[model samples]
Target: MTSQEEIKVVLLACGSFNPITNMHLRMFELARDHLEDSGKYRVVKGIISPVGDRYEKEGLIDASHRLKMARLAIQNSDWITVDEWECQQPEWVETAQVVRHHYEELISSENNNDDVDTVRVTPQLKLLCGADVLESFGVPNLWKPEDIEEIVGRYGVACITRCGGNPEKVINQSDVLYKHSKNIHVIREWVTNEVSATHMRRSLRRRQSVRYLLPDAVVNYIEENDLYSEESEQKNADVILAPQRYTCTN
Candidate 1:
């Protein structure tokens, strides 16, 4: 058996993260825990990259706000990091490119390392998504075939099955994905709250309490910044006065 130090694994999650619900963070945690429990892999880092504004997903806020919210949500965790490169892109970038972008960075850093340990192996990069996103792969034109091949075939994918998501059926349906099926890891979520960003937004719109549904700091950040509220647009003054101010400083 290989020693823990010999192998490294990192998960890159790309999504709208419009307000970043608790489930978004749980996917990373669940994936990492599953990988670590396998004994053959050592989880290293996790990255959260929100989609750019150009994608124009309905109810999605500016990338900067989403990015800040993501950062705030992960502040307490030492291993997770937020990458802004995706949101910074001038045009709408596909999800595969987002995964590759960070994967290449990890490779580049490893190449530049002057103190390489002979026993340490190269890190493994995998795209992290919920089952819904994985199911969407079969949705016509929802994801480009080339992009899907590049992501799952190359870096691979780690998914957490959400309510009503059937990874097995989807894999059985897609020839491209099934070809690299060995690279895929799908875990059924157990303990975490199954919250959705869309649902959270709707709750906010209805002026309902979302406390504890998400990271407290993130909830506060959402409320303090007036994001997702029905009248949030009317609160632009505060949003502008301190657009970057996040509720959690930890």
Candidate 2:
């Protein structure tokens, strides 16, 4: 590995983003702030890769809608952008593949550089996730062991603890997570963010207000499109927003 100053950091967020929440956007800022504060890594890019329509998750809207809403969620952030590659997939793309895909793009772009003498180091790809996503990792058959190794070993994670979820407990308990603990950066929120897409959707189902929970642009888009009008069928029982499950798109 190159020196921290030489290496770059790219944050990739893979999710359904059924309706991106404020904390979704805040994760990038908080991770970036943590990296900068450490004087170790420089954040070069932040990409929100919404799961495709084929992800087949409950309450998941159309890929087109999710992509646009994700774009709107990060329109103002210069370093942050939305990538449709994952969403365009015919089936759900695993998290490891998503990270590798972006890393490959970086290498390809660097290869195209005109300067022959200049050597470019690939930017480190790290998944920006909430504690909920981390929690799901250990679930039986949720993620492949090899994928877990790549996700936490090859590409690391920056997890934001929501509602006082203790990420370290998960990290310290799991062998894979514990082995790659150095790669994981845990950001603890003194004031836990209780917001999530499921909560927003449930609120919308009941005709409740969701303002300030998500981006203003997203709020306007959701209203104009009249999304989440139909009551949730709760197809994925594990996906429901609860105190224990903080909603991770998976």
Candidate 3:
């Protein structure tokens, strides 16, 4: 496609980046490559927005630490950046709201720009996620129907194929997803890295080496903060010392 015909797009990934692992960062690269290779869209930016503490996911950590780890994970990336707006929210923000907020924020900035000589095209904001999240749509009441429509039908979705999940099957099962299947792109992970924040947390809890699982800076920060350690878990008044369960955030 010609430059003038190319659609500008921004990818927004919202999740509990508890201790942002390599896989988390890899998603952005994979999505960017898939979109650009399609020859219809040019990926202009990638934003990682960590869920707030109010989300209270089983293994989620403080937003501050998660935010810092996310920033550290993308220190060398040229296009990816972390946005703290969601983390700073008083209550947990839904995925749809997060995408909408960023989309509007970008438009506001473009409108206020003083440089008239440079023309800016409004970018299409797409929700980036793993197939696991796509499958979550089928869970009973896990997500509202209209919110699903707003996110997938309006902004669009770039879902990465994850192990043990079928994005296409999930999309086909739901009428809403089927209606907007054209807007959803399922990206394949040719490299097949199954590294996840849950596995990383388990390794850390056992005091195992996560040397290459995440960035050196993030690992070092976790060490310095004594996070996810047995002692740290015991110190938390809210955490119960269960035999088979690790009560630490990612």
Candidate 4:
């Protein structure tokens, strides 16, 4: 039984977490540190986003395995917990809807005993995203023009900086977003690491050492499952080298 005063929550921290990495842990620590230093809201938990059917990428591992890996990686962190609701959904859903629903559920649960209760409900939600996603905000098909209102109007977002993109582009585009809803906020911290899941996968297939790239648990999981074998690596290399054959669709 947790006390109401000890239930402060912040930052939804959503992501595929395909294979959790040191970067992910670093971001969590940074967010918590920021909240503490600012002396504002006390962050009580970090929510992990499990993969759903809506992912556009091809050749993803099973969600169960991914979820297991995420759980293993965060096992030592008492403040972080895995949220499997996204992966468990029976149908595909939009990102905006997911955000709204999660907050709504939190609010509803908090007020569940309102009939004769003296409990005050306090629910705050923040969306965590990478800079790449922020740059692509104009194109999140999941978010309709109005859905943006529901999101920024109701919750705050934490944006982490990533490479290969300009922050100004994201800010300028966000002007239009602000017109719709003003609750959106961005974090300017740059993660500095060039690690990405695609590169990790490629490295694994090539039998290259991925030390210090991904979390130890994820590396172990990949090894135990025999993921990304040498044959696949060779095939990928061949495809990259032999690539220029475009045909006329007419």
lDDT of each: 0.79, 0.81, 0.84, 0.64
Question: Cα RMSD for candidate 1?
Answer: 7.1
**Per-residue error (Å), model 4, residue 59:** 2.5
Candidate 2, residues 144-241: lDDT per residue as tens digits? 77888888898899998866478889988889999999999998777667887888998888889899899999999988988886644354435633
Question: Model 4 residue 204 lDDT?
Answer: 79
For residue 72, give model 1's deviation from the true position in Å: 0.8
Clashing pairs in 2: none
TM-score of each: 0.87, 0.88, 0.90, 0.78
lDDT of 3 by residue, 144-239 (tens): 777888988999999999555678888999999999999999998877687988788889999899998999999999999877865543433464
- Candidate 3: the clashing residue pairs are 18-250, 19-250
Q: Tell me the number of clashing residue pairs for each predicted model.
A: 0, 0, 2, 0
Error of 1 at 213 (Å): 0.7
Worst 10 residues of 1 by lDDT: 241-250
Task: State the TM-score for model 2.
Answer: 0.88
* Model 1 lDDT, full chain set: 0.79
Assess the local accuracy of residue 107 in candidate 3 as a C-alpha lDDT between 0 and 100.
Answer: 95
**Once superposed on the true structure, which residue ranges of model 4 sit more than 4 Å away at CA?**
1-7, 54-56, 112-119, 140-142, 162-169, 180-182, 229-250
Q: Report clash pairs, candidate 1.
A: none
Model 1 Cα lDDT, one tens digit per residue, 45-109: 99988887666555668888998999999999999999999888886677777777787898788
lDDT of 3 at 167: 80
